[model samples]
Target: SSPPSYQNGLWGHVGKTKTPEDVDALVGPRPGLKGEGHLFDRLSKNRDAVVVLDEIEKAHPAMINEFLLGVLGNGQMQNKKTGETIDIGKSIFILTSNCFQTMITHRYRQEKDDVAALESLHSSLANTIRTWVHSGVSASGKGE
Candidate 1:
């Protein structure tokens, strides 16, 4: 279960990322703002909090390769500016994306069997997302 005001932590406008600094702002403490980063600050206040990073596919490559890899792989991240280690082991992260919505919808409409369509879509989406994440290129074939 999530907190009632979980919407407060929604990161809907995580726009283009040009540098590591942008990644820091999302997961680590900001450059000059002491102890202030969206994910870090939310987890610091409430370990049970649920944070949503909407449209994750739009995030920069550095964000996926650097911050997300560390967080998802290790369950923790170091605050670059504060030199503090933030543990995300207890926090719930919800990543949302519409990368293949159209394809999925079209497949479902064209396919007669629901189970087969779901299986095919699942396999395709998984492989595509895995490739995009590892190769630093988005599903759109655009390098961020």
Candidate 2:
């Protein structure tokens, strides 16, 4: 099997799980955000996934934090939008960010209360990519 695809906009619409009755539905997934779905979650769900978020920090800080915690591991997201709450169930999450150092610093700075350790790990991986880029080993290292 190849993959599935959703033809909506960048961030697809929230399903009918949040029906305007549940208080938690109003809260959404990303804490205080309105629409409750992560772009990474959406992309990961696609069949032929090639997701790329350039400056990930520019997105809702809280959303990013929530995503780093909830979805990135096994690509699971709980959407509290439908007044009831729904889960993406399965996703193929891929993320990119420029705030590599910042995330790491924040995680190390608050190891006790940091819920985004995986975010820190992702940032560290980004740093590794940067190192590869700087050392000219990322793309050109393929024997050129």
Candidate 3:
């Protein structure tokens, strides 16, 4: 049988990974970072790779705002500790989360309109994502 996709390797309980150094370990580290291999580099070697990041809401905020911005925005991950950049333009990352479900259920539980609830939830989530993307100290020069 074919092996599971590399995306299947993410460890749970991501809140402990506090900084960019921890972010490098979570994404996978390179020799330059004092580690053996990088998942982004490995996946990029494939002609087509779909990377899945499950439970994204649980990840450390620093990793998202600091490390992930470079990769998700520019298709390049700059490992601040190692001063190495890994090219991730070829991979597609699917991020999944269940965090909003509870809020949606509780907030609109009394309402009977499913469509409205969904729309409201979408707007809230979009605003939250916008805040997270722009909350950093420096603005991203590269346009999305």
Cα-based lDDT for every prediction: 0.66, 0.41, 0.56
RMSD of each: 4.5, 15.9, 6.5
Rank ordering of all candidates by lDDT, starting from the highest = 1, 3, 2
Judging by lDDT against the true structure, name the best candidate. 1
Give candidate 1's TM-score: 0.75
Ranking by TM-score: 1, 3, 2
lDDT of 3: 0.56
TM-score, candidate number 2: 0.34
Question: Taking the tens digit of each residue's C-alpha lDDT, what string does model 3 give over 39-127?
Answer: 44454355246666655555666556655676789987654445566676766776666666777677777664778776877798789
Best by TM-score: 1
Q: Write the per-residue lDDT of candidate 2 for residues 93-134, one digit (tens) a residue.
A: 444444356656766677846657766676767677656434
Q: How many clashes does the backbone of model 2 have?
A: 9
**Candidate 1, which segments miss by more than 4 Å at Cα?**
1-12, 16-21, 29-35, 138-144
Query: Which consecutive 10 residues in model 1 have the weakest lDDT in total?
Result: 1-10
What clash pairs does model 2 have?
3-47, 4-47, 17-82, 18-81, 18-82, 18-83, 19-82, 19-83, 44-92
Error of 3 at 84 (Å): 6.3
Clashes of 3: 0
